[model samples]
Target: MTQVTLDDWAAMPRNRDEVSHGVLVAAPLLDIRHQQAVTRLAYWLDERLPDLVALAGVELLLAEEPLTIRVPDVLVTSSTDLNVRRISPSDVRLVIEVLSDGTVRTDRVTKFSEYAEVGIEHYWIVDLDALTTRHAQRP
Candidate 1:
């Protein structure tokens, strides 16, 4: 498998690929329930944080060499620019992931660490199976 850099990942077509530890990986198709959760979260964030931007499925570039990238289900940021293909961790205020059977481990472990390392203030994991939301805040 060929390693992919952040720039390479960004240049690819949207909703097509992701980089995991510098390796290119295909993005999984989101199920209807997951989509619904992301939509609802975006709406809720928009209502509560009018000054910030809430987006769904946007690429969040976390690291450079041995590149790491993740697309959160829903993300809240103060950035106003919509033309950017990838966003830096500094621009992100919060990240939310709607748990699916295929991504439980990555969301809870891999992404959790990456988000924290980048100093993201808030992280939320919504587990549809358990009907609960787990929240984490950086100190």
Candidate 2:
């Protein structure tokens, strides 16, 4: 198998996928509840953060050399990044991951670590199943 670079991942069609530690993986299949939760959270965040645009289902390039990329359920970024191909950690103000049955651990543990390591200022894991949200801020 060949290594997939960030440029390769970026050029691919806008499918919700992830490049994890140099391997490609499909994003969790979002159910109706998951979809609704993402939409609601984006709208709620957008209203509160006027300068940043809350976007849903956009690619976040966390790393470059090893090509770590993830598509957050909702991400808050500057309006200037609205038309960009991928939102880097520096450009992302906040990222929200809506937890589904299959992605609870990923959103909670793996992503929690990845986002922090990538320098995202704020991260929120919304667990719809548990009806709770955990917010983390980088110190």
Candidate 3:
């Protein structure tokens, strides 16, 4: 049980020049539409579900800390987990990743495996252009 701060991950270079563990990583920049969609979805969920009071968007989950667990799009959790600032993967009820140009492969493959490893119940990948969402669950 180790705690990895946002600063630790942020320290990972966001460009090809910067390298971590001898690996070069390029961080994906979120688009305006992605932000808007997240906000709209959160608001919509809030209106419909009272139990799910805290909906987080693109918030980092410190589960398996030092791994820099960040999820895009949307997340909905129950009141019991609301008071805590950082949440474990098991606490996450739903994870929605809105696919973007840079993230389609990572979203469809890497993240899918990670979320499942952490025991996420429901997962979704939304295709913005096609207006379709792909769903998966832990088995």
Report the CA-based lDDT of candidate 3 relative to the real structure.
0.62
Count of backbone collisions in candidate 1: 0
Tell me the lDDT of model 1 at 2. 76
Q: Give the TM-score of candidate 1.
A: 0.89
TM, every model: 0.89, 0.89, 0.70
lDDT against the true structure, per candidate, is: 0.82, 0.83, 0.62
Please give, for residues 1-139, the per-residue lDDT of candidate 3 as tens digits: 3344456656753331222232334556778997787778778877887766536444445343334456446776764746554556666777777777887887788777767766777777777787754455452
Measured over all alpha carbons after superposition, the RMSD of each candidate to the real structure, in angstroms, is: 1.9, 1.9, 5.4
Better of 1 and 3 by TM-score: 1
Local accuracy of candidate 1 as per-residue lDDT tens digits, 1-139: 7788766766777783568789886767888988898899898897899789899888888888889888888899888887997788899988988888778888888888888888997898888887755555452
The ten-residue window of minimal lDDT in model 2 covers: 130-139
- Which window of ten consecutive residues has the lowest lDDT sum in model 3? 15-24
Model 3, position 45, has a per-residue lDDT of: 72
Off by over 4 Å in 2: 132-139
Model 3 clash count equals: 0
- Candidate 1 Cα misplacement greater than 4 A, ranges: 132-139
At residue 71, candidate 1 shows an lDDT of 81
